[model samples]
Target: MITLQLAWRNLWRHRRRTWLTASAIAFATTLLVFMITLQLGAYDMMIDTSLRVFTGQLQVQRQGYHAKPQMRATVPDAQALAARLRAASGLDGVAARAQGFALASSVSRSYGVPVIGVEPEFEARVSTLPHLIKQGRYLSSDQAQEAVLGAALARNLKLQIGDELTLLGSGKDGSIAATIVPVVGIFESGNPELDRHLVQLPLKTFQEVFTMGDDAHAIVVSGPSHEAIPQTQATVAAQLAPGSGLVVLDWEQLIPGLRQLIQADMVQNWITYIALILIVTLSIMNTFLMSVLERTREFGIMLALGSSPWRIGVIVLLESVYLTLLGLGIGLLLGGGIAVYLHYEGFTFPGMAEIYAQFGLPGVIHPKLSFAGFTLGPAVIFVFTVLAALYPALRIRKLQPVEAIHAV
Candidate 1:
């Protein structure tokens, strides 16, 4: 207790130096927390958008479909698989899809498009297609020979809801066939690849038109929670394929680019954090060194009055710890307040909203906080303080009483 009191008094004796060192640590901690929060928020947004807009949490496909996704490559027991998936505890919903390439034409323009056949109700529950319907109505379960065109595709072909459009493509036999499917609705997915080439039809109609019978290109499964995806996928895979012949793809596997983006964001966050911590460490070290040099006479006087070298070292370490704790308390309050504010209100980048909209991403970014991050700030600062005092502690150990007393 006496050592702690003496340390506190010594720290205040050089108030400017102590404040500068503490402020350095505080600023670094704040910056580190803010940067990590922003990166995590962006990464979460990207993953959520990609999963909800493009792929569900998990997908089940035919054994060889991923390598070659032609009309012929399909899972024969897709309905059974979907049924089992629906019964699974961790799964939210399941939907089957069939995809093929065809040429679509109005009187004014013609373009090659990818046709996706989906069950209206199940697809709506699994993906964002229902919400993306910008015009008319989503495909009805009873609607036959009806098609939904992407907004960009509609613009290119000069099509509107209720317009008749001719589709030219090879049916099941690779024999060219032409069918006129009425445009039922227009959609905007904010993904150019999907918006420009995707056309939607009823699963049964697509099967009849494309000659697919009791087979599907893929089965998409949504999980009750994002973290439950892997566990649900394992359960679904086991039910769908008793053997190792089939491949189950999670959202991360389906979108390699998105996975890479998340990884890069994490790496950048760590690098930024390490750099800031190093800066704080250096500042604390410099402050400790200067304090020791200025207090040589005082330290020698204490030692001559019977204070041991061990006590002197303990005093320096205690002073560092006290200053670090004070700084960390301030930094945590600032960082925690910032994180909570951004998590609720969110941060918006004005002009970039449209770009994010085009990619089916949310305009606002909300940060999520982890308990480790909130508590780690002070713990790390305490460690740096100890390390910074090492040089000063060693210098005090070597100080000769006469030399130190006469130096100042």
Candidate 2:
């Protein structure tokens, strides 16, 4: 208790230096807390926005279907399965889709494209594609003999709404699939990859034209948010019958490229965080070294008055501990308060939505607070601060009482 009091008093003895060192630690902690929170929040938004554009948060497909797609590789009775799963699973939406490659033709031009059949009602709930339409309207019924296509695809084929489009492909049972439908809608996704090669048809017409019956290539599903995906996926999987040749894939499995993108961004953030910690560690070491040098005479007098050398060293260590704790407390208070405010209110930019339109990302970014976000940065600072104080504390142990007291 007496040693702690002595250490605390000595901190106030050099108030300016003590406050300066503490402020450095506090600023680092606050910056780390907020920065990590922003990264986590941004990642969540990026993933969900991308997935919602076409690939929902999760998908149910036949085993090995994703590695190599074949017309024959399909989820049997997919529509019924989707209905059952939707009623039982606590998920936001579930829908079935049939996909195939076909040669799409207008009166003058022809091109190969992916033809996807979707449920209008459920698709509106699970996908943002329906909302991207720039001309005409989305499919009105599962039975409508109409199609929606990308603007670029329509342009490539010299098509416009109400124009006839002929589709020719192979059926799931190896039969020839052919159909002609009128184009009813056109969408511009802003991504050339999607804009140039995709078309959509009513599920019922597609099933007949492709001879797929009620089977579908994939079952698309979504949850309220990315964080709920794991639980939502588990609920759907549990309801599947034993020996069902079906598997559920989350966003990561559905898009390996997106996973790689997030990892690359995380590595960049870690680099910045590491550099900040190193700077704070050096500042702490400098502060403790100065304190030890200026207080050498006081330490020597205490040693001569029957205080052990180890006791004087311990006081120095305690002083470092107190300063670190004080900084940590203030940082947590300020940073956490600001983060909480942003989390609820959100931070936005005037032109960010337009900028992100090309990739389907959100404009507003909310800072998220979690146990890891709050503890990881401050914990690293505390460990480094203790290490920084070690050399100065050890100097007190090597002091000669008579020489230290009489020299200066």
Candidate 3:
């Protein structure tokens, strides 16, 4: 306790230098906290936007369907399975979906695309497509032979609302499948895969046309948010009967390359953070070195009076500890407050609202302040600060009392 007091008093002797160094530390920490938390929030938004547009947060499918999607591989009794999963997962949004590849034809043009089947009312719980309709309306019944087409696909086939579109494909039973449905609606999802190649029909219509026998290829799921999906997915997976030949896939698995993209961006962020911390570390090191040089005679006099050289070195290190703790404490209070505000109130970029509207995403981005975000920055700074003090503290070991005392 006495040593700690001595170190604290020493800091005040060079009050201006200490304040400047501490201010630098606080500023750097604040920036790190805000940027890292903001970055995490942006990632959450990106995943939510991409999933809600069509893929959903989780999907239950045949074990091998995702690896090699064949029209014949399917989950039997889709609505019943969806109900069971919904009850077990405690998720509000669970919809059975059927999919098949077909060639769509209009009077003058034709294109090959994936045809999906959805339950109209249940689909709205899991998808934003019903809300993205730019023309006409979404399917109103489970058995409607009407279809909704993507904007790009409609343009490719020269199709418009109320136009008769014909679908041709091989059903699950290896028989010829044919259907003609009126285009009731068209959607622009802002996702190329969805916009360019997706076609939707009532689940019943798809089953009948695709010979799927009341079964669906996938069961779509939506949780309250992306963060809650893992728990929901685990609950759903556990409730499935053993050897059910089914698997639950989360957003990371459903969306290709998304995790890799986030990880790559995080690496870039850490690199920038490291560079900033290095600058702060160098500044603190300069302070410690100057303080040691200015107090050389005092240290020498103490040594001559029977104080060990190691004790003087210990004091220098303790001074570093005191300064670091002070700076870290103030930095965390300011930075953490900023992060908390962002997490709650959210923030909007100047013109992002319009862009969000175009993409059907929420206008504001909320930062997710996690434990990692809270500690990672401060921890790194503390470690670097200790390392910086080492150099100046070690110089005391090489000092000779007579030489140090007579030095100008």
Candidate 4:
């Protein structure tokens, strides 16, 4: 306790210098916490949006359908398979969809588009599409001749709600299929490709138009949260027969591109963290070394009065501990305050939605202020600060009393 008191007094004796060093550590900690929190938050949003936009947590597709995605390569009796999957344990929702590419034409313009047919009520439970309606209304199960267009698609085609558009595509049986449907909704998917080239129609109408009978290209399944995905996938896999020709895939398998992007972000964040530790280590070393040099004569006096060299060294380390603790306190308070504000208010980057959309990320980013981010930065600072004090403390032990006292 006496040694601690001496160390504490020593730290405050040079209040301006001590505080300045503390401030540098504090600023670095704040930046580390904020940047890491933002990266984590952005990753969370990307995973969620990518999953909810279309893929869900898992999907049941015909063996080659995902790779080829042709009308002929579909799950036979898809409605029955969907029903069986829906009754499985740990699954939250199941939506069967028949998807294809078609050319959409209006009186004044034409554009090639990707089209998907879904059962409105079932799809609503599995996808975010129903909630993304920008103009007009979402599709209804009873509306067989109605379709929804992506916002950009509608604009390019010069179509609007209640406007008629003609679609032309190849049917499942190798026959030409054509139909005209009224636009019921326009949605902004926050994905550039989807918003520019996707369309939605009623599942029954899609099957009829494509001459697919009761087949669907994919059945998307979801759980209440990400934690339930593995269990839900295992249950679905076990339910399938040996020769079913159906395969279940998790989000990571379905969206490898987005997964790879997150991995890259993690690597970059780690590099930044290592750099922060190096910077803090150097700063603490410089400050504590200067203090040791300036107090050499005092240390010499203590040595001459029979103070132990080890005890004097310990006091130097304690001073560093004090600085580190003070800096951690200040940094956490500041970083946590900003994190909370970002968590609630969110940060919007205008004109970046399209750029982020290319990678399937959302424009608005909301940082999550969790315990991990709150503690990690300060913990690293504390460790490096102690390490930084070691050299100065050892120097105190090697000091010769006569030489140190007579030094200028």
TM-score of each: 0.81, 0.91, 0.94, 0.76
Model 2, residue 389: displacement in angstroms?
2.4
lDDT of 2 by residue, 1-408 (tens): 999999999888878988998999999989988887877888888777778878888899988998998888889888898898888885548999999999999999999999999998799778888889989999999999999999999999999999999999988888999999999999887768778999999888899999999989999997656667788888888977778888998888999999899999988988888899889889998988988888888888998999998998899899999999999898888778878888998867788867876555666898877887788889988998988999999988899999778756
Query: After superposing candidate 4, which stretches have Cα over 4 Å from the reference?
Result: 1-16, 63-68, 89-92, 107-109, 235-245, 260-282, 297-318, 337-366, 390-406
Q: What ranges in model 3 sit over 4 Å off?
A: 305-310
Q: 1 or 3, which is superior by lDDT?
A: 3
Which number leads on lDDT?
3
- Which 10-residue span in candidate 4 carries the lowest summed lDDT? 355-364
lDDT of model number 2: 0.88
lDDT of 1 by residue, 293-330 (tens): 98899889988999988899989988888888878877
Clashing pairs in 1: 190-358
> Can you write out model 3's per-residue Cα lDDT over 235-290, one digit (the tens) per residue?
88887788989999988888778888989999998999999999999998999999
lDDT of 2 at 62: 86
lDDT of each: 0.79, 0.88, 0.89, 0.85
Compose the digit string of candidate 4's lDDT tens values, residues 254-287.
8899889999988888887879778888988999
Decoy 2 TM-score against native: 0.91
Q: Which stretches of candidate 2 lie over 4 Å from their true place?
A: 301-313, 357-360, 394-407
Worst 10 residues of 1 by lDDT: 370-379
N/CA/C clash count, model 1: 1
For candidate 4, the lDDT comes to 0.85
Output the lDDT of residue 203, model 1: 82
